[model samples]
Target: MATAKKKIHYAWWTLVALCIIVGLAKGALNSSAGLFIPGATQELDILTGNLTLYFSISSIVTMIFLPIGGKILAKYDIRSVLIVAIILQAGSFVAFGFSNSVWGWYIFSIPLAVGGVFTTVIVGPVLVNQWFKKKNGMALGIMGAAGGLLGAIAQPIVGHTIANDGWRAGYISLGIAIIIIVVPTVLLLVRKSPQAIGLKPYGADTASAVGSDGAKEELDKGITLAIARKSSAFYSLFLFFLLITSIASFAIHIPSYIQSRGYDVSFAGNAMGAYMIGVLLGALVLGFLVDKIGSRNTVYLAMVLAIIAVLALLLATDSKMVITLATGLFGFTVSNSVGTLAPALTTSLFGSREYSQIYSTASLGLAIAGIIALPAYGYVFDFTGSYTPVLYVILVLLILNIILVTFAFRGKKKLLTQGHWN
Candidate 1:
């Protein structure tokens, strides 16, 4: 038989398209949720503490449904799932415009969060994994940056909308706009995977994936959930996510944080945008580092930067130049909670076969953090009339995160030696 040659496929194009849709939808919703805080509380005549519980509701929904979301994604057609998810998320956003009662937020937050799991949390990584057999970290990083880029655009627009037309209009317009944009792009462009369309993974041809195939590590050995549950490393990594995300959860409060410190809403919004810019920068740089230097070193670098950034935030919160620098630095370190560490660490520990399950199981830490931290910030303000306690807590969490990362790496090394990886 004659040797065969390969041809370029359309799957890479599909991945790029999904990235754009997924990125825009995630960017607009997740990044802009902070903009709604002030108005939701003020208009509904509710305590800020009460209105913020909506976030807890959303987080709970995401945590509960994450595994189901994964199984559904694996079972269904990608295009169909995405369409339903977009409508739920984007449509609920528009419905938020009409909500005069707090119950609306509590109820609809379920669908919105379920949609969020599909679009923002699960889609990018799963889609990338399907389409690109190589450079996956880079692809995911860019997808992560999409929210930052969109946030860069959305934070300012949301600030202006609330300032001009009130928060109602802002929510309605952004919600409808995201649906309009994402639906068409996803429907027309995204394919399920390379294999679904009869092709090899992107970069599989004339790329390092082929050359590196000979010594390919045992890439799909998934420890059962029970076995993984029993590992010390699992708890360590969970704490890593919990603490790190608790720190990053500050992003949602930055708008309120700034206004309390005598900054204008516009300036606060701009600061949020700048913070997201730092997220884009950090996600890209660190992801590249993980690909080059290994996930272990990249994590330590991220943790150290987080420590410096938190200390900076604690000290420089009152100065314009210093506040921006500190918050931006916080953005840099905190995004590893969502952007780099989870997926990287998930693969490192459990491999690919059970990746979504393990990742989702570990993600309850984010929900748990929200349940505890969101209300804690509100109560702290109610008591002390300040965010200083929140800052101190964040610093403590980041320091603990460093210790967790070290243990996770040490555990992975042991797993490899035990032949779980071979």
Candidate 2:
């Protein structure tokens, strides 16, 4: 029977499905947030501070509910969750088009956060962990890189749509498109586990399962959420998580930040494109490099690139060439924010036993950073008459990130040796 059954690998198919789902979800939604900010403000006559508050509200919801979302994922069908998630997130985006009052945005922000947790945050890592036992970092990097590729494709289209179709029509069209594109892919290709297709993880052969002691060996798993929560390593990882997110959340404000610097709106949009393209390149490089050089060292290199990038933006905002170079560099550096640390660090410390729950709980850092960082950057510009302060602030965070990650890994080493952990 084993010889007769045809063998097919689900891992590659899973990658394709992720490239499509994640590509569409992030490329369409995140890249388009810039397009909506101005329109939502102008059409509703809302202040920039309050309009941005809506995004913070959504982040707050995500932060507050991520653990709940994790527990929910534990119980439910991923396909069904993803379908509903895409609808709520993208659907709420579409609802912004029809919104007349600020109250509409505030209300829809609830489901939007809940949905985003499922589709954007938890889905890729969880699914990848289930499918690939080897080269997991590369898988995560590819997922992040796909988002970059899609953003490259989608942002210009989003810009064009907002420029030509008006914001409402643009939102409506893209929202519906996200659902139309992702739901079918999810239903057709996404399965919760490799066993659903009659396979072990890509490299897990029974031949390798026996230990020298004549005992059956099992895969080492990650630290449970409970233990991870108590350690200095977790807090260090948390700070790194926060710093990286602040860097990316700062992306949402780049177009506006560009405008504040006496540059034209068109230039701002183009700079964003440059930034995302940089992110794409960086993701692929870091993912590949991490496997070769190791995760901690790769992080150091990326952080240096990010610091240089942010400093360039501070000093060279007027030069289109320099700003473009800087934005791209920063994009590359920050792309590793999602691509590398969470899973790599998790597996390095624990193994995989409570992988999903541990990662999900830690991801509250992401949600919380979005809430605090987004408007903090905006309001800095609002009150201070320039973004220079925030740029200086980001420089500090990047440096601190390097320290945090170093300490987190160092602590992990101690934990492993002491037999108190790992």
Candidate 3:
């Protein structure tokens, strides 16, 4: 008799679909926004600053919509929510292609950001939490890595398209491509939970076979959102989100810092390439570390690495090679905030009981950081004629995160003791 082939888990399929969908939404659509600015401003005779105000508008909308999006995702069918989200996001990009003035960008940016709240921010972590009982950190890491790699590939293609065919074609083409690719992927592969299909999450059977009740009960193990909101853990996690984001925002000023130190734009570009590579590799390594060690330990390691990177930047200015390496190290550490660490920390501190709601509420800090950090760094450089002060501030914030992570876990202990971790 022929041996029966073992079937792969649907959770893995869900992960694959998420990799493609989120990758394109982030890499192709969101990351490519800056490439169009030169073309849009030159063609439309709009001031670059005025045209970029759409980004601020997008940020504000994202901040306002995040909590609402979290609530919606928790209450609705996952497929339907994601389908509507991609359309709003990609549809806005398509609308940008047809716009003739800066006002058009400002107006459409609202829906664009609204869509992003679901597609890029809330959906991936929430689904992964629902689908995987084991290797959840690795899953988040893979998603983040995929997005980085896809963004790296997409940027060049997008730049080429805009250079050859113009910004309008680039915007419309990429937008339509996202919808075509993502909508079907969601409909076919994504589900609200493994239980929805009468299957357990990946590794859940192993957990059951080891004499535990099952994954469903395991999934339900956590502090409720109301209790979590009242805990020190939640507030510590919130500050972690804000401060880490603020620290990572320094990436925007890196090229200027390089130029200020007498390196040319070419060198700065190469350093940025190194940084991207670090982010890609960092996601994979951090995820694996989270699986092997745990999220808290992984966070501790990341903070230490960040501290080293900052020290290298501050002290190793004489060597071009050192600067490049330090930038890459910095990128590796900071990529944690984007997707990997935030979700892992949430699961570690609060469990999956009300993950979407709690994670999204904590992520208010992310949107707030976006609005404040970039301009704050710019103004610091403008007033002082150097980025040194900003670097020192980042170092301070990095140290603070280590303390916050410690406090967060302590708060979790308190919750467990108080019987709030139901």
Candidate 4:
């Protein structure tokens, strides 16, 4: 019996490469930012509020660059764009190693943010949409899970390195390693679209009639960005992005919060490892739920988890075990909102037409959240000697997100009724 072996789809290969590239960018480089704060502040004699202000600068740059970066990604070769992006981002990290003053961090944060807009913000969702016609939620979830797994490993290692070798060494070593790994991955595996390889996106056969022309027609179906911008769903999605990002930015303060609660840095490192593990599990579960239950219900569930996590954090600070477990829970909720859920929600509400433009424009909230939330947490801690107020604010925001999700779906209904959804 000479049965032919069916070739594996190249989309899976593209997904694998994306997992590595985005995982390293987010897990190793971005997630490690908080770990350096204690060492950088203590050794350099910088104020916590002052040292973290660089994060605001980075956000400002990100806000300015997001729309521009989106356009750039759409126009350029994916590999070339990602290659230059990694160098800018990782190169900035290397520069931070040589910095003895807060000003160095402030200055280099520009390029760091500029590069991050492409690698962290736009690339994963854009590529996933381009490659997977079905199970795109699962693909995004897998990518997020990969980031979480890598972050779980990287967090502890980075913590130990900063503890043993100092923040400078930690920064330079990590930066160099990421650049070495990512450049080749982007060059070899990343492509702009499935059509570039003369193949349809994954599940394209099931999604539409069997022909290139039909697939192309199916892909373009959705509300135009112009009309979408006028809808309530767009505004609600923007607020969701803003509030969720504001909540997630609390991650950068978790280590400092631990230290303030009289825990040692070693314990903080373990907590962060727990957090990443939660993120890994959360991404997988959220992705599955998005596929099965839809994005709105999935988000409702995530918001409930967040409410519990915040309540535990507020009420159970005396127990170290509770703190660790609550932190892991918090990580699970935040990872879903920021990494897995946001893109899924956007796709569900708006469809794929003008997705990159719509997503990037709405992501101004993410940038604005970073600018305000990170430093605000630092300043609150600096002034009040507590993160308790910040926790309360997060609790309120989580409830509001539940409301926003409902409104976003309602707005989508309006669009459908108006025949704006093609």
| lDDT winner | 4
Query: Which residue pairs overlap in candidate 4's backbone?
Result: none
| All-Cα superposition RMSD per candidate | 3.8, 3.8, 5.0, 3.5
Clash pairs of candidate 1? none
Can you write out model 4's per-residue Cα lDDT over 187-226, one digit (the tens) per residue? 8888889999888898988766555786677767788889
List candidate 2 stretches off by more than 4 Å.
1-11, 67-77, 133-137, 191-234, 264-266, 346-362, 406-422
Off by over 4 Å in 4: 1-7, 70-80, 126-137, 187-234, 347-361, 407-422
lDDT of 3 by residue, 1-422 (tens): 23432777888999998898888787668766756665676689876556666767889998788779999999999899999999999999999999999999999999999999999989988989888878786787788788777766665566567657888998899899889989999988888898888988888766557645675788888889999999999999999999998888777567567666876545655565566667778888887787799999999999999999988988888889999899889878986555678888999999988997898799888878877786677667656867789899999999999999999999999999999877
- Highest-TM-score candidate: 1
Task: Provide the overall lDDT of each model, using Cα atoms, as 2-decimal numbers.
Answer: 0.76, 0.77, 0.83, 0.88
Report how far residue 76 has shifted in candidate 3, in Å: 7.7
Give the poorly placed runs of model 1, Cα more than 4 Å off. 1-9, 74-77, 193-201, 204-217, 220-228, 346-361, 409-422
lDDT of 4 at 352: 86
Candidate 1 local Cα displacement, residue 46, angstroms: 1.6
TM-score for all models, in order of appearance: 0.86, 0.83, 0.72, 0.85
Q: How well does candidate 3 score on lDDT at residue 398?
A: 92
Between candidates 2 and 4, name the one with more favorable lDDT: 4
Worst 10 residues of 4 by lDDT: 1-10
lDDT tens digits, residues 246-363, model 2?
8778788776777677765456656777777877887788767777987788888888888888889998877999987887787787856665655576666556767667776777
